[model samples]
Target: MSTILIIEQVLNGLQSGVMLFLMAAGLTLIFGVMGLINLAHGSLYMVGAFAAAAVAGVTGSFVLALIAALAAAALAGAVIEVAVIRRLYDSDHLDQVLATFALILIFSEGTRWVFGSFPLFLDIPDALSGPVTLPGGIQYPLYRLALIGVGLLVAFGLWLLIERTRIGIQIRAGENDREMIAALGVDISKLYTLVFALGAALAGLAGALVGAIQSVQVGMGEPVLILAFVVIVIGGIGSIKGAFIGALLVGLTDTLVGIFLPEVLKLFMDAAPATSAGSSIASMSIYILMSLVLIWRPSGLFGARA
Candidate 1:
């Protein structure tokens, strides 16, 4: 590939990575703080996309759509936390998984009932619809670049929240010792609700942002959810920093491999076979990376040792 092509792919990788970070960050936070295996998290992502699309269709305002997305997802999260998740805290992972998986079905059906079976398209705002030129004459999508910036800013803000603020301290402490914190009068139930809502809002934001680039529809979050899980596992279950780095690694590996692996294989095989093989191998690249990382560090890149 040419230098420009490589640069573009790298930027694409970064964009993908950042989006994954948005999804994975929330997943990690929820898992880290609550020790809950939430399969319904992706449902909240769908909720956001649907909310944003509905609001945007009505108001024609991207900003308002985003706000709606956050509000809707957070509301859904809080409701579930109170109605369902609260009951799962002391339950085993199997029960949590089963309950959340049921939630996924309910969410999917509920969304279909409300939005119908059709996919909705979210338009890019005029301000970010065009491509911009970079220093090396690289033209990139402004909206995608904006996504990267937003993800990074959120990451920074999350770090500050966890490291510098009282709530952050409680979250961290809860992750380490929930009972102790509860004993210390930390209104653990409220904190759990807040964390779940915050995580849901983040997932919703990701869904809304990505919906502009892709179609917004029920079950849209499932695929992304799988990737987010991979990111968290590779990054270490409860580490935001690890999630960020792992997301970048996964995004870069996925994008670069999908594009260049075929070229590399073509050197040794015919184009058709090479393309097929490359595509197959590329699909597993992230999982392979995960396996390798596990071999190197069982707890994940940033996960605390057990």
Candidate 2:
């Protein structure tokens, strides 16, 4: 199609990738550091979105909603860690998954009970609602462009947080040897809680940001959760750098294929068949990419050797 359209889609992919990074970054940290397979992490995301929606509705302020989202998600995560996840540390992935899956149901129903089955709406700030002219006569949404800037900022911030500070050192050490870190006088339990809460807060921020564009609903996190899982898996389970790169690769691949597959297929096929086939395969593009990555490197592109 048009070059402008391509550029727009690429931007969409970047936005989506940034959101996924927020989700996956927390997940990778939790898994790598705590050794906990938390299925309920997605629930934290929903909690953030719903909290933001409810607060914004009452307060009429997006900034307040955002703060509430972060607080709610972090509180929920810490509580869960104390009540449920702490016990699962020595347990198997199956038990962790089942318990967290149940948490997902609780979160969905709990949210519906409070907000009802109807979806909550979020409005973009007035300043960001207008379109801005880009290079080459392209006009784009200021809000979306803002999202890209926010995403890039978050990416850099996370890198600095994980790689620079003393806590970051502890997190990396915990990821490498949990027992060793524990033996060295580190309060590993507290560290785990902090990590979980941090992860939840990031997920919440993503939900709040995305809520402006999509409806704020109870089950909104599941789709994103799955995508985040795919992202981390492709990037390598415990690697932040890998997750960032993998997210970008996935976002671009998914958006480009979805937009251009039909046109490419129409070269040899009828428009109707091309459109249908292209749409179907486009949906499958990420999975196919995942399979290819796994086939060539099972541990992921940047995973440490087993």
lDDT of each: 0.94, 0.88
Model 1 Cα displacement at 142 (Å)? 0.8
Best by lDDT: 1
- List model 2 lDDT by residue over 1-306, tens digit each: 788888888888888888788888888889888878777878888899888888888998888999999999999999989998998999889999988899899889988998899999888877689889999878888988988888889889989998899999999999999999999999999999999999999889888888888888889999888888888889988888888888887888888899899999999999999999999999999999998998988988787744
Stretches off by above 4 angstroms in model 1 are: none
Clash list (residue pairs), candidate 2:
none
Error of 1 at 70 (Å): 0.5
Worst 10 residues of 1 by lDDT: 297-306
TM-score of each: 0.99, 0.98
RMSD of each: 0.7, 1.0
Residue-wise C-alpha lDDT for candidate 1, range 83-151, written one tens digit per residue: 999999999999999999999999999999999999997888899999999999999999999999998
Query: What is the Å distance of residue 51 in model 1 from its true position?
Result: 0.5
